[model samples]
Target: MARQVISPGWKVVIGSGIGISFGAAPIFTSGFALLTSAMAHEYGWNQTEVAQAATIVLSATMIAYLFCAWPLDRLGSRRFAATSIALFAISLVVLSQVGPSLSQFYLAAALFGFVGAGTNVVSYAKAISRWFDRKRGLALGLAASAQAGGSFIVPLAAHGIITRYGWSAALLSFAAFEIVVCLPLVAWLVKDSPPADASVPDSGSRPQIAEPEVAEADIGAAEIVRSATFWKLALCFAAIGMSFYAIAPNTMYILTRRGDVTAADVAWIQAIGAIAALFGRILVGLLLDRLHARVVGILTVLLMATSMLINGTATGVATMAAASILMGFAIGGEADLMPYLAGRYFGTRSVSKVFSWLLFAFCIGAAAGPVAFVRLSTLSDSVVTPLLLLSALQIVPVALFLSLGRYRTAPEPAFNLAAAPS
Candidate 1:
């Protein structure tokens, strides 16, 4: 049989990728850090205070993920994603209106975190997986690159807008953009798989529709938690997250603190990192499809740790820029690995739920990372100790992954075998 050309499934992959990027950018690391700096300067809030709000947002998101998994699976990806985008846009507007009230800022961030749960990696991972089975790693990486892409544009835009019209106006504009641009695409393009009953197996490299029986074999959140493999994967990701997130919120501050680099320089450096991240996501995605994920994971962890060490000791612009690139590359692979692994090891039926648990660990790391860095900085009156400590701590995940032997592989019944349509 001749191979079929491309399929419409690629549209879903493309749309969800852009949607996730749009939904995540404003509140994610790069954009959020710029906003934090603006708010801190305007309100006289310290680094710890600004970082604490982020911690609150992440912690709330972590909790919300626990409940969102079922809703994501049940409500369908389109509705869930649309709602998440709307809520996120509203939250951005509220954040803009947070003019003299720290309480309002924190409240809005926490709300964003809660509603933003559906916009996380889990939202699109299963949906994309349903569309493409053969190169699922690359598909997920493509989706994740949206986040990297957003990081590039949003932070640069946020910084420029804040510089011109003030932070409030910047946020309002972002909200407007998200509603007008992102929501429509998500509504039009993002969707769950067609019912398995009438599914057709596509020729060529098109993803085969999964068998209902195979999907049904997937365990629930309760069952996943009971398994030892689940916790190991969870903890491993948490450690990676902790190390990377420690630098994310502080990158601008660290680069500019010594007066060697200006705000514009920081923006450019972050943009560079974002670009590197996009490539990293795509590259790792391709690699994961063919290579042992554990090996890929270890390399990513090493890059992250090395970046931390460089950032901790760097005194020049070139060194700081190099550190940023390394960090970005590591993060690109790191974010894609967990979700890909979860669905690979577990079953697709419960991908949203299983990955949600992993996302909770991600959120914990994100929440703890910034505060811990800021607290250590304040206590020690320097950034050195925190960076070094985080760099050293990367070992936890490295060790955990090294021992993640059987967990990375599929269970007794191979899910990969069931990935193709009957």
Candidate 2:
């Protein structure tokens, strides 16, 4: 029997991609960055304070990642994703009501973070893992690319809305879009994996299909906590996360303030970054399928470091856009590579929890990065110092990933294609 070139299961990848693309966009750092200037001007808040609100949002998401992982494992992803989108929309609406009081802004941010995990990569990864075993990397690459897809467009649109209507209106518009667009797409299309008893199409030759070697014993959360690999992964992610958070919140502001770029110009540059990120996810996904993830991870980080150096010395649009592309690639690589590593090393059985722990570490760094950049930039009176530091920090993850042990490939199992369902 000739195996189907495309599995019906690819729908899961598409659905999850759409879900994450639309759902994660508005609450994402890029979206928040669009509001930063407006909020600061209207409320007399500093850049640091605006970024602190973003930190709170991420911090809340981090906490949610910890508690929700187990529940997700037990309850399945469909309802959680749907409900989270709903709650996320509500959070946006509430945030749109922010006044001069900084306390209210923080409170809304905390709420957004609390409900934000459902729309995160963690939730979608769980669903995608169940669908494809051999083509997991590409599937995840396609799904994770949705983030960049959304980031590409959301910031541009949000900036336009903020410039014309007001920040409050921009928030309200995003909330409405989330409800009208993402909610229905997720509800109608997204679902958990098909039943194990079902005949799923595995990519292979007509005579034989390679079945993945399933582990007999599932890895538990406690074992992961005790392992040296886990700590290293966590620490590496934390550093990268901090760098991302710091840069994302400041990208437009830095360009506008230092490079003399206007909001419209910044919007177009950000869209280019999003495109770079989209390609990065696709490239990383393809590379992970063929090469050891550690090798790919190291190379990707080095590329990011190069971008950071460019960004630090950027003098105009040409240089800044080049830097943004590199930054986007780095961000996209992190999103795809980490989850792929978790599934490969830890076993899909515990990927949700394992990746969540890693995400928590990332959040800690993310929370710290913005504040640190703000302080450092304030003290130095230039953004270049902070950019260079972030570039330097990429080396930490590169070193850690480089030191990782080679993956112990499972023995491939022989299959009788006639006996198996096509």
Q: Pick the candidate with the highest lDDT.
A: 2
- What are the runs in model 1 whose C-alpha is more than 4 Å off? 1-6, 195-216, 407-422
Error of 1 at 209 (Å): 5.3
How much is the lDDT of residue 174 in candidate 1? 83
Clashing residue pairs found in predicted model 2: none
Please, what are the lDDT tens digits per residue for candidate 2 over residues 1-422?
A: 77555554676677778778866543476677768677888889988888788788889988888887877888777777878889988998999998999999999989988887788778878777766666678888888888888888888888888889998998898888878988888777667776555445344433222233254357877887888887888998998888888877777657875677887887788889888989999888888778888888888888788988887888799888998888888778887877888877776777788888888899898888777888898999988898888888887999899878755333122354447667
Top TM-score hit: 2
lDDT of 1 at 75: 89
lDDT of each: 0.78, 0.78
Report the Cα lDDT for candidate 1: 0.78
